[model samples]
Target chain A: MFLVKIYVQLKKDILDAQGKATKKALESLGFEGVQDVRIGKEIRILLDGRDISEVSEKVRQMCDKLLINPVMEDYDFKIMEVEK
Target chain B: MKFGVVIFPGSSGEGDCFYVIKNIINKEVDYIWHKDLIKDIDTYDCIILPGGSSYGDYLRPGAIASKSPVMESIKEFAARGGLVLGICNGFQILLESGLLPGILLQNENIRFKCQYTQVRVENNKTPFTGQCSKGQVLKVAMAHGYGRYYAPEDVIKDLNKNGQIIFRYCDAQGEIEISANPNGSVENIAGISNKKGNVFGTMIHPERSSEEILNSSQGRVIFDSIIGYLKGVTVNGK
Candidate 1:
């Protein structure tokens, strides 16, 4: 078994509106000197695979097909072996 | 001509769209479930993906619904030059399906905006806008949280050059300005069409404002335009 952790975020050129709102709230709470804040999502998945490399390929396809919006978002994934 | 309204698991706009087509527009309409693969897609002259938080907007708005079986058939339908209209969440699905360019992000103010808004018709050549005069401002209602339309500079340029930009947020007097933008879309874009002009997606709910009793029958012009085009009305000699 393998556990995959994926992180998705808006592309660098795109504005993160939610992140900006959270930053404003943070500043209001006295967290000063913050340069910038960007927000994204993290998704975890478990899969049964024969090898890590094969699992990595499947995860990439999953991201491209469904997990991320290619027009505005980028994604990265990490896989680790786990006991069934 | 027949129309099909796709209903995703969490779709809430099908009833409104169905009503508008069956009652207001007086046409044949059917509800297509998300899981159903439409074999007779060619029979429908138009298909509508209406507004709502499909799949409860899991992961992202329209993300899951875009991958549903019905979307595949809709994609094929659009490829064949069948008119496709996507409103609000439907617009988001089109983007996610890659049937339309650009992406709809969270509103700049990070708030859900629901109000009657004005949009100017930028191009009347499309089948969806043939009944509207160029630069005519139509009053429509927009309700969504992620209504900000965004694209790369090159894509925006192409859209402008090709007249794919169908609608822009404008004031009542038909002046495009930042103040009239409800969700901070780039260049105040409220709606757009694909290069072929058969696929259109807009943030505004034309069906909601389609009745005189609603105080704005202007939205009916869009449907009328479609009906006219299907009936072989040559738009701008196109």
Candidate 2:
């Protein structure tokens, strides 16, 4: 069996409203040189099946197929195998 | 099977959606009042949210309707892996309800465009769109004020990678196009679905073109896909 973790975020070319709010807050606190910051989250997938290799492949496919939006967001993943 | 369609006070597409899903599609469907809570959405197979000016788009489009009682049950159903589809205004509601992600913004050109637009299918393995093939393009009607879409870059890439970027706008020539990028939606997107692949939302009018009178024969397949999915479920017994 295998498990995966997926992380997604908006590209730098795009604006992040939440990040902007946070940046403004930090600036008010005297933190300088903070050009900008973007916000995103990671989805953890602990999948179980007989074929660990195939599940790993599906996890990557899921990232491309349903986990990330290629236009504005980029994604990365990690797969781990477990023994019964 | 009786499908539930929610009706907000200023909902514009109730009649249109009801006619298509009920009369044309020959399915038993009902309209649920927005004020009332859907006590048991698990009883039904599909739930639809029609386009509307819910809460008058006060703070933001769908910002208010996101908290409606009917939507609460819709959320429950979606959590249980039931199917739900939102259109235009409904798409906004989905975002606000957290059933889906991102927010709808004003049209980039700032024009109230009401016309036939082309869209490409980004996924095929869902309850609402089983019949649609990946990358298939279809022309549908679009009308809304704040329909632009926005989400985190990683979120966009994740949805695209996950095959969730349904209904991407295209040109009449079926080229990957973006002109009326309303609300600065990422990639000129018109619709999306959740990670579970059960919930879907779009800023288009499929019900308007279910008949030849609307000058397009593409919308029917959208509904057909849902029906197919429902039938499959009945056959499998959950």
The TM-scores, chain A only, for the candidates as listed are: 0.96, 0.76
Best by DockQ: 1
Give each model's whole-structure lDDT.
0.93, 0.78
For every prediction, compared with the true complex, DockQ reads 0.86, 0.02
lDDT of 2 at B214: 82
| DockQ, candidate no. 1 | 0.86
Question: Tens digits of per-residue lDDT for model 2 on B1-238?
Answer: 7688899867888889999988889998888998887776667878888987887876457766776778777888899988888988889889877888887755655566688878877667777667877777787888876777888778888988887887778766556655644345788888899988899999988898788888987888888888888778322112
Fnat for each model: 0.88, 0.00
Which consecutive 10 residues in model 2 chain A have the weakest lDDT in total?
A63-72
Report lDDT (Cα) of residue A36, candidate 1. Answer: 86
Q: Over the stretch A1-84, how does candidate 1's per-residue lDDT look in tens digits? A: 999999898999888998888899999999989878999999999998999999999998898889987889988888999988
DockQ, Cα level, model 2: 0.02
Q: Evaluate model 1: give its lDDT.
A: 0.93
